[model samples]
Target chain A: MNYFSSDFKLGILGGGQLGKMLLAETRKFDIQTYVLDPSDEAPCKIACNHFVQGSLMDFETVYNFGKQVDVLTFEIELVNLEALEKLENEGKKVYPSPKTLKLIQNKGIQKEFYIQNNIPTAPFEKFESLENLKSKIQNLKLPFIWKCTEFGYDGTGVKVVRAISDLENLPNVECIAEEMIAFKNELAVIVVRNVSGEVKTYPVVEMEFHPEANQVEYVICPARIDDKIAQKAQEIALQVSKKFNHVGLLAVEMFQTQNDEILVNEVAPRPHNSGHHTIEASYTSQFENHLRATLNLPLGNCDSKVAGIMVNLVGEENFSGPVVYENIEKIMAINGVTPHIYGKKETRPFRKMGHVTIVNEDMKIARKIAEEVKNSIRVISTK
Target chain B: MNYFSSDFKLGILGGGQLGKMLLAETRKFDIQTYVLDPSDEAPCKIACNHFVQGSLMDFETVYNFGKQVDVLTFEIELVNLEALEKLENEGKKVYPSPKTLKLIQNKGIQKEFYIQNNIPTAPFEKFESLENLKSKIQNLKLPFIWKCTEFGYDGTGVKVVRAISDLENLPNVECIAEEMIAFKNELAVIVVRNVSGEVKTYPVVEMEFHPEANQVEYVICPARIDDKIAQKAQEIALQVSKKFNHVGLLAVEMFQTQNDEILVNEVAPRPHNSGHHTIEASYTSQFENHLRATLNLPLGNCDSKVAGIMVNLVGEENFSGPVVYENIEKIMAINGVTPHIYGKKETRPFRKMGHVTIVNEDMKIARKIAEEVKNSIRVISTK
Candidate 1:
């Protein structure tokens, strides 16, 4: 299909930062895009050719939006599966098909699928309800990880249980009790696949979590590790993607145990934060590759020109309202520092306002600059 | 001032492809932007926060738009100088100040300024009209390059006159007759300077023009020339920017004569086509650097990560109307090939509709792929 400057329309389900970045690639190719997002002030509102404000979880809204475009994809995974299934039956293309999403949406089912596929993962047990887990509390590991079966995002819907009393305050929901593995590091590899089944995997990236927030603070490319370990992580990620039969980008989060065993933790079937540094450092950005994958175009070169580190510009504690990026100019002075503000008009505590990417031919210099950037810039509120 | 996610407004004149590319940087920084263009269907219309449809050459329109912005810059050089001067006098920050533009808007004045500043340039004489040129034909060199003093853009308003009869059909307007120098190569260097006086120069790029159209067909970075010649070109470009006291990007085009001496051909005081390859090859793209310079932010690294060659995508002859990029997919299959389609709906013969960038660690490989891309893709109208 002649998508460039043609009548072909691509429908995107989310209009947040990922969608905004994806639109940049679409704009670059002059591909027509229609975005359906719930917010009136979505960052993607301006770049897309068409904007429809509607909840992605609503069946009718998603189905209507899908019907208008030749191909449909989502930046976020919390979309209406029924609508996607219906669209597929009606002959529309929905990447990361409903079946793939169904198998991965719930934590319980995802764990089950990983085991069935013989993928290495932490041991876990699925509970229909929190009550069932409470009734058998002593039989389970004391310091296990408890995660809700569905609707878990970011660091939410998750908790670490230490004692029986900890379970008392937890919400009653379908959940999983996972044995906590003492991993040495968290790593991720983004695998991209086109409709033709041609696949490519980005180099493994290490995620450094904030001590208090339990959220990713830095995504360092070419994760500082042995080459053998990196290769293992990539192979596992490829294995996961092939098993899922996923389309577009699939970012596999893995845990490197003390013995260097790589175990699957979770996966996000879209552009992941771990791959954001690709925009400045790689031959082809993950966002651009995602678009190419969805369009069934040949995958681009996925090699990095330099080592890159990403620093998330989350809102500071106790700051809310109109956003301000303090000391942005200071970081801009540093070589190879590129800040990407998501065009979010407002900010609250812990809200992701933007990110800064630092790249250098020397990884040490890039990391030092990343630290300087982290120390200089602050996401604050004007009011 | 907090530019990112703040209320600081950046006003840009002429929403053509340059403005569209600039908007990509603005969006990256989350800097609020207002764009003015005569056409409602301009490429910048959708990407900017607020887009005003108005002639960039109208004093009232430009002034009104300037009033609403804290800082004003332009992608096109043909904007009303009177309005910019008025805005600057009223304390509005305008990069590449009106005074600098005044010296550039007319070829006669630009040539005089270069000569007065001791800048190397081809010798030239000003003419009040074609009749005046005809009257003094005997005194002028036999084969001189005649160019209209004002409003000459791209390859238009330029002619090679070898005889008195060549002036018969020329327009009756102020013009300049320049001594034609025998040049072996056409080169360009982009110099960027921030308001704080921090200046940097991109590597020299060589332009290969179409034999007939006299328009640039490919822009090859690193110039494929001796390091000494490249250094000389960069030094001259920097000198030109400093002499003009220019802020933002100043692209200096030059002619390398048979003796290897560099002479100034002309200059564009904004992002130029010659530097478009920097978007994929350099550590910092010209558009991003232009924004940083305009905003008084510290400059980024000017080094290139890989060699890049850009092929301009012009509309095919005998085809005009709604445009289609035929075989774009076929080209995408080639490694390191990226197509950037300017969202222009209509096409005319030799009109620039887009460009393709081919990048590779090896320059020879990049050039080879560029030729393959040029042969595979066709920019033609479907209707």
Candidate 2:
């Protein structure tokens, strides 16, 4: 199809930062886009051709939006599966089909599929409810990780349980009791595929964690590891994508265990923050590649030209009003530092406000600059 | 100015392809923009916050639009300068200041500025008009290049007058006759500056010409020349920009003489076609930097992570109606090829419909892929 500068409309389900960045490429190709978001203050509220405020999980809202566009895609996975399935039955095109989302939406089912497909992952047991876990405590391992079967993300509802009291606080809902593997490093691999079955995987990246927060603080490309190990990680990621027959971008989070073994952690179906550095450092940005893949166009080069690091701008703990980026001007003086404020006017504690991308020919220098950027900028409340 | 997601407005004087691309950045930052253009079907018609249809050169139309925004900038040079000057006197900030535009709006005066600043350039003589040129032919050298003193671009109103007959078809207008110097290559250097007096230059880029049309068909990054020569070109461009006190992007087109000397050809004070490859190749795109510089924000990194080449997609000569990019899919199959189809649905011979940018670690490979893209896609009329 002639998608460029045409009357064709692409419907996007989410209107946050990922959708906002994707809109940049759509604007470049002059592709018409329609955005349906829950909030009127979405980052994509102004850039798209049409904007509708509606819940993505509402069957009528999503189905109606899908019917108007030539193609449909989403930047987030928390949407109504029934609506997407109905839209597909009605002959509307939805990338990364509803079936694929269902299989991976719950942590328990996703882990089972990996085991069935011979994909390496930390061993875990599924529970219908936290009450079931209590009844089976005598047979379970201590210091295990408990995660809700569904709707768990961004450090929410995932916790380490070393004692019986840990189970008392979690909701009595379907959950997964996962083995706490002694992994040396956290890694990620982003794979792009189309309906034609063509697939490509980006180089393995390592996530440096903050010792206290249990959150990713820095993502380093060309993971400073053995070349053979990196290859193993990429090979496994390709197998996962092939097994799932995924479309668009599938970012596989993995763990490199102490024995230099790769294990699947989780996956996000759209552009992941782990790949944000590509906007400044890669030959083709993940956001651009996501658009190309969803449209069934050929994939682009995903190699990095230099080393890159991303620093997320999460709101400070004490601030919860109108947002201001303090010391943002200081980082601009440093070479290769780029701050991308997501155009979010308000901020709450722990909410993502923006990100800073630092790239340099020398990987070491890039990482140093990234640390400085992280230290200088604060997304704090002004009121 | 709290431009991000605020009520502050920026008024643009033209809604062509350049303005369309600029509007993309403004919306990305959620800075409201108002565009003024004569054509309601302009490429920027759908993207700007407000698009007003009117003559860009009309004094009243231009002045009235300029008054609506906090600041004013333009993508096209052929606007009512008198109206802009009046707006500036009324305390409206105009980038590439009206004074700088005055020196550049006329080619004869621009050349004089170069000579006065001791900038190296090809020898040229200005004439009062084409009627007077014939009388002074005895004093001028043979086989000279003739160009209109004002409003000449894209090889328009320019010709090599090798003999008297070659000048017969020329209209009576003030023109400049320039000596055709032997040059090894054509090059360009983009220098970005802000009101804060900070300046930075992109690497010198070499433009390869199409032998038959004598037009730039591909622009190669890093110039493929000696490092010293490339640095010299950038330094010369910086000197020129400093002399003009030019704000925003100043693309200095240069000629690399056979003896490895860099000579200034002219300057364009906006996001220029010569810098388009930077969108994919540079760490920070030229459009984003243009917005930043205009806002007096800190500059961005201008280094290229990979070599890039851009091929123009001009309308086919035989087709002139609703536009279609025949075989666009074929071009997508070529690695590193990304097309930017400007939202121009109409087609006309020699009109720039869009461009394709190819980036790769190897310049040689990128150039080859660019050739495949140029050969595969045809900007034609569906009608």
Candidate 3:
């Protein structure tokens, strides 16, 4: 396609940190990029060749932005599917096609697809509304996981329904009741596929959750799990990508149950955070592979050069104003630690400000340093 | 200095490929940068927060640009020393200070500096003008190297004086007459120092020149030499950096004499081409270290993760117009091969278009792939 230093323009939706990181790969290859985001101060606003400040959810905005570029892709899934469908109809290339997104966007549909395809996943019941669920509460499982069918991200739009009172505060929205499977570890495998059907899987990564927040605090690549489990997770991720016929990065999140049975939980069809550590540790970072896949370029080697652990820097509690990374220098002093700040000037409690990647040949040392980095650096706001 | 996602603006004087690569680090850390270059289409124009189009050699332009940032550094050395000196006097921080630049800006002065510091170097005599050299040709050694005192870069302003006729076409400018020593290898070592005096040296790299053009064609990291030779080169590079009290990256180019003695050739006090492979091979890239050094942050790990080889992508002979990289896809399919296009839209003969870095665990395999990459990709132009 003559993408390098040529007239080929690659359009990216959602100019957040993922888009910012994607721009790094585009800049490395000298591929022209146009970014669309609602924020004027988006992290990607500086690196892209052109930036259109507009909503990615608005059909007209997304359509107009797509019209100016040769190829279209999105970092976030909230983009307007109708617009992308129309663009594809008109002969524009949209990776992870609208059809793939349609099947994966709704939790009810996603779980059904997994069961129909004979993929291993927790059984779930689809509910048209919270009222509908209440009417049939007597027959359903008492302690199932409730998740909204659409618009969920980063632990949002999800809840554990342990009892009747737990349903009182739930929104009356289309949702799914997923069987709560007792799991020992949450893992993710990123599968990359090019238009030519070339596919590759990155090493499995373990997601460690914050005990109270129930959110991922660290992502460790080459998860310290049995080799057999890792291989199973990779195979499952590949099956999901093949079933969807997706062309791009499909990050499949899975759970290892008490009996070591790997069950598919969900998927993010883009450069997922679980693969962020690859930037410093792997032969080919997930973001670069995503770009190469979207462009139909030959995929790169996905081997790890060293073990890597990523610690996300979320905003501190009770602090909301101009962002400041306290003790950033302290962590920089540690060997093999590289911090990537998102360039957001403001800070709100629990908001993602940046992430720090710790890499080392010794996994144990890398893990220890990751803990040190997490403890030493605080993302706070200055009034 | 609150450089991370703060108001601290790093002013870079030249917005060429070096500055573009440096901007990648600043963008990764969310550090604000202001770049100045004469061309509006410079590779760094879009990446930097602010870009000023002005001649870096003009004192007023450089002084005005320096006033806008917290600290000033130049990717290119041919900047106005008067402006930097003035800025330093007014309390602005300039790394690789004007004093150090003044000593190295002129080949005559740089050679003399080495001699006065008791450093090993080829003996040389400075001349007021080329005419002065002609008057003393009878007494001087034949087959010596002749170089202009000021503004020489990338094998330009240099010539071999084997006969009196070799001086006929030379410019009437201040020059140097250096006794040419028989050397088996041309090596380089990059030494990084922070403002607080912490220093580190990158692995030595071996440079192979184009036989006809006298320009470096390939740079192999961890030079294929005995451990003792590598240590000697690093020690000599450190001694040179200490003598200059240099801050930021000091790329010392050296010669390995036939008898295994190391001698200083020249140096560049910024991110250099020889260290370009570090971006893909080392734990800390030279660009990142340059940024850390200038910010007075602790140095990063200087160890290499894999062996790296870099091949310069120069414009194809007799081609001059819009640029195109032929068979780039063919080379990209190779494992561990990364091509960095410099975003230069036009192509002129012998002009540097970009560079490709090939990395592998085995140095022999990496070098073989580098050769394949060099032979496969052609930087040509469409008229």
Question: Top lDDT: which candidate number?
Answer: 3
Count of backbone clashes for each model?
0, 0, 0
- Which residue runs does candidate 3 get wrong by more than 4 Å? none
The candidate 2 chain A region of ten consecutive residues with least summed lDDT is A208-217
Q: Model-by-model lDDT, in order? A: 0.92, 0.86, 0.93
Cα TM-score of candidate 3: 0.99
Question: What global local distance difference test value does model 3 have?
Answer: 0.93
Residue A306 in candidate 2 has what lDDT? 86
**Tens digits of per-residue lDDT for model 3, B1-383:** 67878888999999999999999999999999999999989999989999999999999999999999999999998999999999999999999899999999988999999999999999899999999999999889999999999988777789988999999999999999999989999999999999999999999999998765567789998899999999999999999999999899999999999999999999999999999999999999999999999999999999999999999998888999999999999998999999999999999887788999999999999999989998899989878
Q: What is the lDDT of residue B65 in candidate 3?
A: 94
Could you give the interface RMSD of candidate 1 in angstroms?
1.1
After TM-score superposition, the amount by which residue B51's alpha carbon in candidate 1 deviates from its true location, in angstroms, is: 1.1
| Residue A153, model 1, lDDT | 79
